[model samples]
Target: MIAFFLQGLAIGIVSLIPGVSGMTVAVALGIYRRLIDSTKNFTKHWQSSLDFLLPFWAGVAIGIGLAVRLVAYGLTTFPFPTAMLFIGLLAGSIPLLLKQYWLATVGRKQLDRPLQLLILVISFCVALILALIQLNSPLSGLSMTFPTLWALFSLGVLSSVAFLIPGFSGSLLIMLLGFYALLTTRLMGFMHDILTNSLYIDWNSFFFVITFISGFIIGFIIFSHFVMAVVINYGQLTFASAFGVLLAAPLAIIVCTKALANLQGSISVVLVMSALLFLVVGFMTTYVLGLYSTEFTREHPHQGS
Candidate 1:
């Protein structure tokens, strides 16, 4: 339970980054398959599934709540360093995922290397194109009308699809749909208002939030089932495509960092050093966590079950 929570927390934090995918972090932590399997078979394994998923869901909620404020502040105050840290985290997980693939196919006599390569290329291109589009035009600040609420719900569903796809950034999708700023602002504001003065509640904002969350829940469940089915049938190809998208995530972050820096004008040497330090720190953190997860899984093979 504790492990699940920690994994969920890590995923939640990483998911806040524009170019980082929570599913990639889950894959790195050795929990991706377990999560999908549990979700897909929840009815048959209700007790164990709840034991594993409850804490994870709670941690995800808490982590996202905390990350919104922190990440929002970081982007405004220290965009370069923050971007670098997320980039490092995304890049650091590549080795572990690749090792997982290798281990799964260790004794295979004949492998479809060409098909895997093609899938990888296609996935990378799709992710790269999406990232490029986000860099060129970032949308924000839409009014919260009934139509906008429906749009937000639709965006939530689409973003949830990205969330399920490794290396695809859900936040990037939200931004592209022009809902990122409004969503964040409303969330932060709602929390603040609730804490400060409970009587002054914004019903419209609350409704929009609820609608978006409902859409996300519906989308997550549907996508999880779909992904699990695909994995069961085409495990190797699916993982290969996921690997390609994961590889491209860091490049997307780098592109966004450059674009953001340009918008902010010249960067100083001190800032560059700070960003580098954070990048290295982020890389080492993810690498160490990956090692721990690998070792843990080896020892407790049936942990989630």
Candidate 2:
């Protein structure tokens, strides 16, 4: 149980990274197949799975708590540099993601070239539009508003479901959609209020946090089932769509400077130079980590069903 808990903790921590995949983390931890079976057959295996599931999820919850605090601090203190790092992570991981998929599906009729191209274009366009929408709005810019509640709710669903997708960084998708910082900050503040000033808490903040969290919980239960269906039915197209999202994300970030208005710097050269360095750091961080995870999986394969 302790080992399972630690594995869950690791997955939770890596989940915060836009480029790191929870599935990959689980694979590295040597529990990918068990985790999937436990999830997929919870009803039939409830008695057996609880030993793994409970402690794992508990660790995941705590891990998320710790990581969110770290992310919230970085976003609050160094918005531009931090985002650059995230973008770097995204950029670095893309190649690794492609490489793995290529090796796994080579000569396997992965995608119908013409249809794949069409889906890819559509996915890119949609990703860009959503990225721009989130970039210009209440959550992405961290200027939360009641009017954007519905939009935030929609994003809430994506946030909860993103981690479940294989080799895909849901956090990265959420960040590209402009909700990562806002969600983390709001979550941290809500947690702080619950611990420190329960009575004097701001009702508005409370409502915002509660609403978003409620949506997350609901989304998880409802969409977990939905994701499995889609993946089983259209796995290849799903990958294509995710690939498109990944491709458009960095471009979206580059175009959305106003979203980073909170960046503190009067000199463009210094800031740009700093951002470039952070981007490289982010890229290398994910690339190396993904490489290690891949090698680890290859060395010690688990045959869980």
Give one digit per residue, the lDDT tens place, for model 2 in 1-305.
99989988978877876655676566545576577567667799898789899999889878888888876666666667767876787777676556544543443445577887787799889878876776556353434576667667776677777766665677766667666666676777777888786777765556666776677667866766656555444556666766777788666654443426655456577777887899899788767756755542363232111
Residue-level error in angstroms, candidate 2, position 237:
1.8
lDDT of 2 at 82: 66
Candidate 1 has what TM-score?
0.80
Which residue runs of candidate 2 sit more than 4 Å off their true CA positions? 17-21, 27-30, 103-107, 135-154, 172-181, 222-233, 254-274, 294-305
| TM-scores, all models, native as reference | 0.80, 0.76
Residue 274 of model 1: what lDDT?
87
lDDT tens string, model 1, 134-193? Answer: 577755456668787788788778888888865466875565444666787788877777
| TM-score, prediction 2 | 0.76
lDDT score, residue 7, model 2? 83
